[model samples]
Target: MGWGGGRVLRDRNVVFYLSGVVVSGFGSSAMSLAAGVWTKSLTGSDSLAALTTFCVWAPILLGPVIGTLADRARRRPLLIWTNLGMAMVLLPLLAVHSSDQIWILFAVLTVYGISSVLLDAAEAALVATVVPETLRGDFNGLRMTANEGMKLVAPLLGALLFVQFGGTAVALLDAVTFVLAAMAFTLIRVSEPAPRPAKAQKWSAQVAEGIRCLRHQPALWRLVLAGAATMGVAGLNGASVYAVVDAGLHRPPAFAGVLYAVQGIGSVVIGLFSGALLRRMPERGFAAAGIMLFALGVALRVVPSAPVVLIASAMIGAGLPCVLIAAMTAVQRETPGDLLGRVAATANTLLFAPNAVALVAGAGLLALVGHDVLLLVAGAAAATAAIGCLLGSGTRAPAAAPALGGSVRVEDGGAEGSETAHDSR
Candidate 1:
């Protein structure tokens, strides 16, 4: 299956959007790594160090509320300002020094996480508005590639910077990248229609609309339910990495990095091919396949062979992104532009909140169960979720599209005649 990379690249809007994503992803990845190292250096506590990640992800629980902000303005401007605002927000990190001041870093990262969620919603809305249906898959696949590509170098660079110049250097590096990303966003030439005035409703009511949209659609619900289960299991798998190295494979803790490296490679390969695969498969089918593949990989980890563990890591990585891509692509196609921001945010919350919670739950479970047992349970849970999707493939479609002010209309399976509102530059 040939990925339509050429068509995606030929579009300048996609190119600029990908460039911004790559630039920002590098900074974010680097900063994430360095933040942990920085906290450990100052506080000498692994719990506090891990808290950095929690700070970044915990705000996802508020996604439905925060997402409404995206629907209030044009998406391009929202993306630019969010990037620029976060850049300003990150600058405060440069001032942090003593362990007592570590709270500042957490504060900044929390805001960073909010912006990340906001940008995610806005970017999905913008992509749905501007990118062609035929090329959307390729563009999203490349987007995943660019983000994953950053992990290869950013973490090492951040670690080096932390060792050499301290955490402030990494903060500055990330701030610069945010500013650069803002610049890249400015270069995307597309016409955005003004946001429709959402009838005056209570803030909670507006948020509920996003939740309602996701639940009302049969396809979206099944895919999201499966995605939530898979990601939660993934968080469990993440918690098992060290234990697996020590007990399952009888390797040094450092061997964990080798597994991650192999996993990253698998992620990149699948991201490149996701566009082609989605073209031939329904989102639920694609997502279910991914879930099963991921479950098999986790189950195989119990084999205890070094080669087998590494191969399992690759399979896990390849399988993980499949559901994510399918879910977001489905959102882009199935959602009306008016509610895109809030709906995307709601879906993201449903998918990721479980993962965040599972991180804590997995850590606790590890204390009580063997890594092998934990993985087996995780694999079984994920597999069961996939089977539910497979058996429920004939679930009813969503109710007809809403008559909204924006140009987008809900279409079945991204039909060839999918009407998009775009002004070619």
Candidate 2:
């Protein structure tokens, strides 16, 4: 495809970018589901399977330091190399056979987690660089759709593949997707500056700046905090899915894929409408609504019916992405281009680190608490966060808020559109 000089066809960068996301997201989602199943099959421990997800998320703790790497390099090349590196890393997973080799799966997933850190930071920065400001909301919404849409299908495919073949088959498939995604990335072109001068700032200072940047932006800070709360509980909620299936619904482990697909359907629906929602509802309100929906969904899951579980999955699928996409779009709009990488990373660390902790804690706590109890706790927390966001937001509607990347600028006026968010990507 042509990479330059037209309106429709020339938007190849976005196309390539989304295409890569679709392919890689499918593989990643499949592998993520299969890893847990593989672990359960290898060892009868549910906690051990949840640990596989924990390994995949733990690397986000290093996001602040790792995110700076993106700003220090041309984003396009960084993205290309990172995708390729992830592909190479997944190759090691093919060695797993017996339960003893479970460590290999964890190790590979840990590496994948690190790769994800780079990808999120770079991709955020790159989008700011390549996409028109006006189009970000739609692009981000669509990206979420592609990602969650894969979650709907990939998990089933992975589970079936594992049932028929093995974890090695799933691993090989994931590795291939990584390669294909890298190739897709390489085909897109963008104009980027040389790396900022080394003397521009010390590395430690840069990392600190990223955190400080968010602190100074109240809207972004509040949004991110809400997201953190949501994810923190979401981790527990997610950790309960397998239990909900095995103990609550009395379904086999593979049935979890069916629920995931249901959730993906909800996500895709919300993603399609998200752009319009952003226009009517402020990012904060949109996120708050999502939080509430997710909480209610979790609460419904405690009903112990398969149909109710499916409904809960869709509620979760719809709700999680709203908070995520809203927070991400806010970060992109609020931070300066130079600090976008670090700021995005910092936000991710803040938002996702809690998820990692919750996952680990949930895994351990499952020994003591029932899945229904955990779901109740998660729902309460999310509902509380949602209410807090609404009550604290005061009377100002989100529609009155200024567009982040557009002509209307928001100043520190504490409301939207009053401040001009700097962007020199």
Candidate 3:
């Protein structure tokens, strides 16, 4: 009730930041979809084509380490340079001519992944400083909307570009977008203070601090844990996507795109309303409700009718982003700016890493247990996670963080995070 999306939309910095996210997100989505296709084209093996996705996600394992760099540097420069650097990194993909050179694409993808982690950390921290806290829900929701909106159209555009030109064109397209994103970052108007000097500590210690920050916050941990749970099951669903399309709905393999599009549409709708929903409920409740909806969606997947499958797919899309957006908002509000980058990164690694593991495991499980069993398992795991969150929501009393600068600190019995009260008001 206290936030206005239109007010946030009117801020100049919000406009530029969202612009950068949208542009880069399009490039990222397009590149990711095209990379697998590129690999399949270069080598006839579907296994290797799938490996490209793993290459992109593998850098998330190093999120803690790379995230520390975001804390150490000026976040704006970190963001701008990372985009420019990624632009340079994608150039090598232009030279790939043979399957032997496919390794080059993989290598580039890995670098791209690492840069993405750093970018995420910087963006989270930067948003805390630049955007008003009361409007952060709307701000974050809009950000999600921008990203999901890009995901909706970018791949189709990328595929079209790939077909009309080649992998080189898609690579160049992404590179050009990175350059444009860098330019967009240059346009944001923010007065970020210099980063504090790091105390004498081991690199591992720095990484551990971020992990501890998560552990120290009760609601934040539960939210992230919930996210990781649902994400893992989503991966299980993902591994069985083709199976669902073929065996479940009697649709062809390419029809998987329709289901995916349906999911994206749901995500877009939820993302647009996430801010208002967060206002009405605590972070845990918001996330738990989404997880429950996701559980229903995945559970309904056991029904094989085309109409039911489409509705379930839409529910899956609408439900998945709630926890992630909540976690991001909570971290930004709760963690000190000095520690935000690494903590944000650590949270991300936790929330997303399980999905990667489950993808492989679900694939193996599919060979034996089949898609229906995996879907049910995923649904149950998600429901169990939601119930845990709802039950645990009442137990924790998070300590009030000290005010930094001229900001005020307030804690409303841990229903949600309240970091800088001056901004919050």
lDDT of 2 at 236: 93
Clashing pairs in 1: none
**Residue 30 CA displacement from its true place in model 1, Å:** 0.4
- TM-score of candidate 1 versus the correct structure, residues matched by position: 0.92
Candidate 3 overall Cα lDDT vs. reference? 0.81
Better of 1 and 2 by TM-score: 1
lDDT of each: 0.80, 0.77, 0.81
Alpha-carbon shift of residue 284 in model 2 (angstroms): 0.8
Q: How close is candidate 2 to the true structure, as a TM-score?
A: 0.83
Best by lDDT: 3
List candidate 1 stretches off by more than 4 Å.
394-425
lDDT of 1 by residue, 175-242 (tens): 88888888987877666788888787998998899889888988788888889989999989998999
Among all windows of 10 consecutive residues in model 3, the one with the lowest summed lDDT is: 416-425
The clash count of every prediction, one per candidate, is 0, 6, 0
lDDT of 2: 0.77
Count backbone overlaps in model 3. 0
- 1 or 2, which is superior by lDDT? 1
Model 2 is weakest, by summed lDDT over 10 consecutive residues, at 416-425
